[model samples]
Target: MRISRLAPEVATSRLIARTSGLLTVMGGLGAIALVLGSAGAMHPGAAALGPVTAGVGLVVMRWGHRIPLSGYRFLMAAGVVDIGVFAYASPTVGAAVAMLSLSAFAAMGSFLFFALPCALGYLAELLVMGAVVVVARGDVDAGVAGVLAVLVVGCAGAMAVVAHRAATAHEDALTGLVNRRGFDEALEAAVRATARTGEPLSAALFDLDHFKAVNDSRGHAAGDEMLRAVAATWTPLLPGTAVLARHGGDEFALLLPGSDGGSALACAEALRAALPHIGTSVGVAELAPGDSPADLMRRADAALYRVKSRGRGRSELDAGGQSPMARDLAAALAAGTSGGLSVHLQPVVTPADGEIVGVEALVRWTHPELGAVPPADFVPVAEREGLIGALGAFVWLAACRDARTLSEATGRSLFLTVNVSGLELDDPGFPDRVLATLAGSGWPAERTVVEVTESLVEAESTRSVHALHVLREHGLRVAIDDFGTGYSALSRLDTLPTDFLKLDNSFVSAITTSTRRARLLRSVMALADALDLILIAEGVETPEQARALASLGCPLAQGYLYGRPRPVAELVASLTAADVVDPPAVALASG
Candidate 1:
């Protein structure tokens, strides 16, 4: 197998071992040459010691992949043995210099193993180097030898620090698992291996169910402990060939080589069973012909979405076939008409006064036989089956009609935010279609916000940009939804035709639990302020989170704390009631 196919840690160990082995062999050959050239003065025992140690070191290096961590320790011990042989057989300045250089190299290699061992190894090397300098004073100037020894040890220490930093950059600070960058590299390697060998390659994406509840209820510290526990429990259970990485907050991805869907599913199930208390949902997809890394991950994510929708604490495998449920969803989308789809509104309120400032339009689906199908399950199907345009039209018309009614009932202006898919944006007639919808409902274009996700905005397509500018020119507002969750280039905010930035729920969830996250939220708020964009924080589930957002100078927030998504009539009733009460008391009454 290629060294790149090995696990990162094992690969690193193998590289260090091979390098040290080669150096040992070179030192041995040099020692033998010295003995032959010096004739009567140099001892033959020292010459034999080099070649013998070199052979053993090479053998250890050959097996380095199997004994990853231990191989480095053996090499370090071997270096010490080589130094002892040199000091005893050839007690001269040249031998002293050779042993000291070998000791420095060994010290540098120790860092590839671990931190504590590296520190101890460096100290031991320093002591040995000092003794060599003192013992060889008769052959060389003591002052000069001491100064060279200091320089060599210092250079070795610098090399160790550099190596440690490089390794740490690829490691997750939270769980000590491979981070996203490392995961991408490992995934690319797996893809290459599969292409070469025709071996089955599978990937699984897992999300911890209700992990936010743990962070919100117990504390962030407890949540961190839970994540650590998960990593520790699952790492040993995985096959050595499998690569596990922390994809991000509350999510993990696994790369399994030489495994088909069945094996991957079994592994995911075993992981779920092992962590029953911390419920997890997993999605597995085996590599298809001519698939890239992104294609594999997307399919796995779609499968994960299936598990999350059906229920958490389960594993589902994608075998490149349509499931019966997906077929039903596709059928339902095809039959979607006015009655088949409905709009639900969740209020976004001012944190200080708790007055409803806006409402986010969420689409829900219910079928005769399928019961209440969640939007997560069917939205992708709709998008994939070319029904999103029809679905989007329905949502926009319904939301505008309801928003006009709500505003009339409450006797106040209320802006309505509706989600627009990337597919709709790419449509040449999207802007004209939106205007027609608003005109049909007699809702002012100025009061409607078309929310697009960060990913779409990052696409920066000419068509999308032109469509957005057209919508803006018509007095409609554009929002970058789920900000900070994707490839968010904050600098682009200045150039993109956007009016609002909705900070994603992931950051909001951790705001109260992590000081660093809290600071980050403040920084994001500051950026929005500089861009002159209205900021709305999503997923504000607690009064504490609301207060935190307010303290950070965020004016608007939305989540279950204000109200869960409900029918338009219920939202109108709540809005009417809030209008009658003192605005400051509205929050308490709603709670």
Candidate 2:
């Protein structure tokens, strides 16, 4: 809650919380010994000191929880104290207890940050006690001693199983790809490594094209089948050893290690060509060393939107096939040029009213040589390289700057919504960052929308929901972007903090061809109405598509029909010139 609760401090808090429960039990034992000894019910010697020592452990655990930022360290300290208490109270019993404790420690090893150290401490304690026992008894048995060792090792094995199960609980039941938390962790790790080594890493963020339409026409079973099919298709095409994670619902990411912008692009292209029936919009970015996972994802996602803009089922490389200026921009990003990037906004309009109610802020990189590089090419790299936090901060500043300028120029309270990476939501500093940025920019909080996807909400914790609530508390609105693209349960929708639903474009694209898709759209509209949430239909390419979406009660629309994303000056000019313009002579333009 305090400013000091940032990064390293929070890491400390996590350390303590994890081990506090175990310490509580030990502390109670020590307290009991102290009580009995004082009351003359137990000997005033080391042998009668176990319960009192345990009580002391409980105090440490209690303190650990309160500290909030030193959880891991506190827990490790607790383990050390346990060893000391046991040694003083009763050496023989302490050795046996150490073996039992060691097992529990091993079981929680994977989840605990200090597992190895805790295990070693326990082992050390056991060895010391073992020596003490041999000296006191002068006898070593072949059967009983072996049995004791086996029991201790067995306890450690049991603990390992417990930790493994705990880790797996958050995994996607169908694809074995890292779920939301897992993906966040993997991305964060990549970012940190890239920063440390200055190696280019990338993230490919994509979703199945026309996936919802498949579900609507074939049934939920078929939709699930399609997802599994796509995952199967991509399994091999991904670089032989990359961190591929299912990012909740339909979205998946392939984290490339030591990959350059070009290599990452090649990987995206291969993935795009592998799918036979379904297509995907692939966004790729070369992670800048020192970037946060959130920042990297934002860049990757921005690149993906460029692909979506170019038309789905395609891949956009941050460096390839760009104008000279664009290429220069890519080069500058690779060289770690500061102030080389900026943000642009694409309007989401009401098909019926044609009023610019909201705009999605997209980031763009302007390398000194390349001019302007699309976000898709660089965002993935940022997420993988752990620069996502910096990327998010940059986007926040740009979006706020544009929102203010738009309001001032148009005399309209334009709502500016920005897409956020899942990793951003998991950062404890995210909510605070949002509040501070908004305050600094003097932007109206209600006029700002934070767009998130269903996959992220589903993969993340109740904390994601809580974070959204916190954003709302600070007056910012939240929208579920790319809806119908992920397998979000109805119950989840009921619980998550969402003010709007931005329906995925694929469903809108298929409305004219599939009755099932139309029906699904109708149902979504109905649900939105029931929930009193605004519905923004994306990818409205044709007039017919626009009409169909409006007829189905989708109040807002975005896509080529409205306008392609452009620079601020161009966007302002287009807004001034908007009219009930005739649709393009043709309805559907194939990519």
Candidate 3:
């Protein structure tokens, strides 16, 4: 039973136990001194017992550090021992000595227990001390017992206040869930328990899909209300052993003791079912053989990134196979610092005349052993490992330089589109960084288009919105890439500062196969026209798809039909061979 209850004590309880231990030790020693001083030579047994009890109390205080919860009980036991010793030694010593010992109990009781329990314990101690005083028939002040009672109550009240403050410190003020600090403490404790018991432990990280949009569109107050509603709804659904915490912003973390990956995923699905309107991406990772809290969290975060990358409203379990990739990526990034990463460009053209008007920059990584690691595999790894920022900056700088060179060589104003990570778009300094890169590369902002995934529209925070506006103010164009593949609504296109919408390849793939989908494509084109935004169709893999896109009045298109992603030299050479001396100005006249 003791082992079962040996889970880590909360921060508040630990603080109280430590304070109680110190108070207990002080109370024990003070009792001994008062008795010795008042008695003017204590009884041999009393002198031996007093110091021995005090010494034992000090030892217990030290032991509390290892098992804080158990230590709390030990401190309580020490208090009981002190009272018994004082009761026994009171007759030989004066009643004043007994009263002093009772006062010591009052101080220790303050932090020893909660208000009701502490009050009851102190009241019982007072009764024993009062009886001792009556039996001793020594000149004890009649008012001392009442004064000590009041002191005990006051101390207990103070302890309550301290405990409340400690709890508040660890709680999220808005959501009433554990804050990040509390989550860390709880995760450490959970990891230790899993290590000791060899039980499966899992961590889940949840990100609310498009949460920033909620804050941006409905106002922050409504966002706060939504967060609180989520917490209140989901808190009751968690198991008793699970720890739910707000992990800053629109994310929440769950620590599930004795649960494996499968169970954790189930919990996530259950949460999704409960809050159907509020989409969440959940990542689950079970504890490994030698996993620390940080390792577990990193894995879970990686899994969450995968979920978000694939599409937001789902749960994913970490395969725990990224250690090699993580290592290689770290090494690659280190090497990339001295010029290892490179960019390739894919031409975006008008299907009507196949004229190259813009180029989309794609990052490439050629590993030493792994050869060319695909962006799909390493890009998410970079985002998870905090290397995305550096990698993105490198890509932006290289793309701008290459685009500038290509335009100079062609003597034309060919636009360059660079894919920006959601992290980069959300960064406040991203607009400034783009401007700095453009300044260094001599690439005009008007010739640069920042391409972001459709998720950007959903996760549009105020800062991100402001950043987009700032980028546009500096004459940089913004386009939503992979449009139909994410949670973007056609009606909401005007809400974002988007100049172009690139239809996802999935939709393009369906355009030729499904008549219903072809109609949807036409509607999308009409909506883009209505919104006065440029529409671009991606993955026009065949003449048929391109012909269909043209018939649908889609003005811009990019796919293998034009050309695959190639090195800048090859792309420029191909464009030059196609007689592209200047940016093409062909307009589609027919479907």
Candidate 1 overall lDDT versus native: 0.75
Please, what is the whole-model Cα lDDT of each candidate in the order they appear?
0.75, 0.64, 0.74
The true-structure Cα RMSD of candidate 3 reads 7.8
Candidate 2 per-residue lDDT, tens place, 1-591, comes to 111211212223334443544544544454444444343332345443455445545664566446543454444455545444443343244343433344334233322333444544655555455445534544445455556556655665565455446556546778765677767776776676677777778878876765655765889898787777777787877666487777866678778978887888887787777875677878887766445676567667656655654456788754423344434444544454275776677877877756676678888777555566567867755554445677788789778877788667665556788999766775667999988899999897867888997666555443466788899887787888888876643557776777888888989989989999999999988888788677788888998998887677677789988777766777766665663333221100110
Ranking by TM-score: 3, 1, 2
Please give, for residues 168-269, the per-residue lDDT of candidate 3 as tens digits: 676899998989898998899889878889999999998888887787789999889989988999999999988899988888999999999999999989
Tell me the tens digit of each residue's lDDT in model 1 across 364-395: 88876777879888777755434567778878
Give candidate 1 misplaced runs (Cα > 4 Å): 1-14, 21-95, 113-160, 192-199, 210-226, 232-242, 257-259, 273-279, 309-313, 321-591
TM-score to true structure, per model: 0.47, 0.45, 0.65
Cα lDDT for residue 61, candidate 1: 60
Give the CA lDDT, 0 to 100, for residue 449 in model 3.
84
Per-residue lDDT for 116 in model 2? 43
TM-score of candidate 2 against the unseen true structure: 0.45
Indicate the worst ten consecutive residues by lDDT in candidate 2. 582-591
